[model samples]
Target: MKNWAVISTWSMSYDGLLKASSMLQNGESAGDAVENLIKKVESYPLYKSVGYGGLPNEDGVVQMDAAFMNGDTLAQGSVAAIENVKHAVSVARKLSLNKTNSFLVGEGATKFAMQNGFEMTNMLTERAKTIWQNKVKEQFKTGLHPYDGHDTVGAVTLDQAESMSAATSTSGLFMKKDGRIGDSPLSGSGFYADSHIGAATATGLGEDIMKGCLSYEIVRRMAKGQSPQDACDTALYPFCEDLKQRYGQVGEISLIALNRKGEWGVATNVEFPFCVANEKQKAQILMANPGKNQKTQIEPISQSWLDDYQKQINAPVE
Candidate 1:
């Protein structure tokens, strides 16, 4: 292969996977390439909720959360408070490689940063501050997520070359607290990927989604050769109805996956569409949100994406 291809949604733009893959053009481990990609994002302009220019709290301070995981080693690292450190994902990767199994809260994670020689300044970039103050929740009465829109980004890649890994980071709700970490950093919820089985990620509503382990459910379905979309839908459809049936309220979630075969797929509530990377270098975007207030303009990815993904799976290469 030319290097490796990736599929994910937690990077700055829709091209995050493409951009991240570029970091691996030279010979490097998948884990190292991902770490380098995270570091590069720290100074990059597009992803604010990440590194330096993060989204702000209701009180107008920017706090960030980040996490990194490698299925090959099962090593995971994360930093929650982490101010002005630029590369949250890189720091998390360091933590993962260290003696500690995980890192800490705002002050705690910040203290970890300071001890490690990272600067602890306010990430108050002009654009970042503006987004937190004006751009976020601008017209909403509640000042954020008026329609329950989610703001989490994640990536899960098996890579054409080696090892599976996943990473996720987010600013969380537009006007959330300075320390309100979401399910993104937590495994088995927002993001989960494995080398043997599969990788699955959740978006849309973290709290609601956390009420159930969405990622694990999808992986379980994919284990049955159900295809990524079917696995996500089969795992989610029942849970979505169960939540409403048991609680009498509506909620939503989005999920995407890549199996051992380098194929990618995702499913949502039909309202929130996730962008998918097809083998043909094309993107298949889908939205699954459904209800009275639903925005009905989304379209589904073609079935060929799954068929093609499966093409790479040839009887286990005995």
Candidate 2:
């Protein structure tokens, strides 16, 4: 009667190491696999928004970061402000598994990428550059830029019975320094998962991500008998309250969770908000994105659904 599922911080990644692993309900052979898939996806260029998609800068060049973790081992791999190199997560994974240190940043991570044979490139887009140029001309003191919700991606998964892993990748805030880094690649802060309390992941608004350790907080809440919606809602409630007190700026958080007994739930700050692909259910799997306006309808998983999911958790995907 155990449960397992994957929750990505953002929905845009198609080649996330953990995303690929979750789709197959496959347990990785080693910790390195988490980054391997992330790197492999970087070659396509289109997925750049997730793994290689440079975060749009005020001036419109790409800056990126990534991180990977194995819940079973609590081992961490991280890289910040790395440029051009795809599969940033893989580079970090190698560092964590092969080195004494748990993190690598900026030029250091890029060097590790080269040492490991990861090729570098100029990860810029014509459209994004044009937008930045336009912002510069608007005569505004603060140039405008777009949020690459598409560029940022994170992954969390609890495979079969009890294996959990999380991976995250992103282009940093647009118009940032040539070497700016965001929370996406920060362990525990951006995206984190632990096998002990099911799994959790987050996306959107990184600087404030540290405010409450959002994803992990939801996991702990779910562990304490809160439904997925309850856990996610509770997490967001405080975030909203704190914003009023701190900077008067409201923020959003997204989450998906699976409990130990084969039930699942999702919460977000928008509508038509998220998607899910399960071992048994793969077609048209989008779920509601939590919204600030309404109470998320909480439904109990029928015994049959729970039983079926339990089987899915333990059985290898076809």
Candidate 3:
């Protein structure tokens, strides 16, 4: 059996990772596996940071961003602030085949999806709308900042043939500005892949993530002979410290990587949970946090943590 593997950000991506792992095991293309992984997250109603049930902007509109990259050809496609698309990642995958105009934004992206016969839906569910309504009330009464939650579903896949791909999708920060877009749809920052090297993806505060271009940096480090774990740590930790000094305060930043050799690694400043699966290991969710001396400490996720997450996501809106 040829080597195959997949790694994705967040516990929300575990189910998608499982499906993608099966696809990879069946000798599917990396592009297909990565796209399918992201689409699953986009369609899950309980994941508030992505796709159909994503929370809305300050104006109560659920705008989404997504991107797809093909490592062999270094081709990329992206959409930003798009509305009413059932699977934004699918739209991005379709655009990756185009040579020009591959990145679209706002109404243009939405129109392209509609014209291309992609499934169209409101994107916002009643639950999300209710959450947005309550957020609006709270922000109005307390004058608090509404910028919270930008957990993008990012993934990297390596197929049996050694090909690789990277993709990302997110509804962006809840109660964000009407036209705001995050690193989720931006290459280098949100995702990067290369068949000769490796693949990487990032999730966190898009603003800071974009500044570091952590995904591409990790791949570059891997190309220079660093292992996946070292590449992730070397690329992420120093940047966090530098950003704190230069930009004042840093935000939540997390990254996941998979080398062509089927090795995987992750780095994060926050308590991030991610999913991974390869030929030798079953799909599992793991926790990652910053460690001493600029290293990352990773551990198996506890059953209690999983149970609590399930309850939190399924809890009723008040």
Q: Is candidate 1 or candidate 3 better by TM-score?
A: 3
Q: Which regions in candidate 2 have their CA more than 4 angstroms from the true location?
A: 1-4, 9-11, 14-48, 138-151, 259-262, 283-287, 291-294, 297-318
TM-score of 3: 0.99
Cα TM-score per model: 0.77, 0.76, 0.99
Q: Lowest summed lDDT over 10 consecutive residues: which window, candidate 1? A: 309-318
In order, the Cα lDDT scores of the candidates are 0.63, 0.59, 0.95
In order of TM-score, best first, we have 3, 1, 2
Give one clash count per candidate, in the order shown.
Answer: 11, 14, 0
Most accurate candidate by TM-score:
3
lDDT of 1 by residue, 16-43 (tens): 5555555544444567655554455455
Give per-residue CA lDDT, model 2, range 14-123, as digits (tens): 34434554544554332333344455455444443554434355556666777777777777778887766756777766766855766777777777788879867677
Stretches off by above 4 angstroms in model 3 are none
lDDT of 3 at 257: 97
Better of 1 and 2 by lDDT: 1
Model 3 agreement with the true structure over 83-194: per-residue lDDT tens digits: 9999999999999999999999999999999999999999889999999989888888999975888899999999999999999999999999999999989999999999
Against the hidden true structure, what lDDT does model 2 obtain? Answer: 0.59
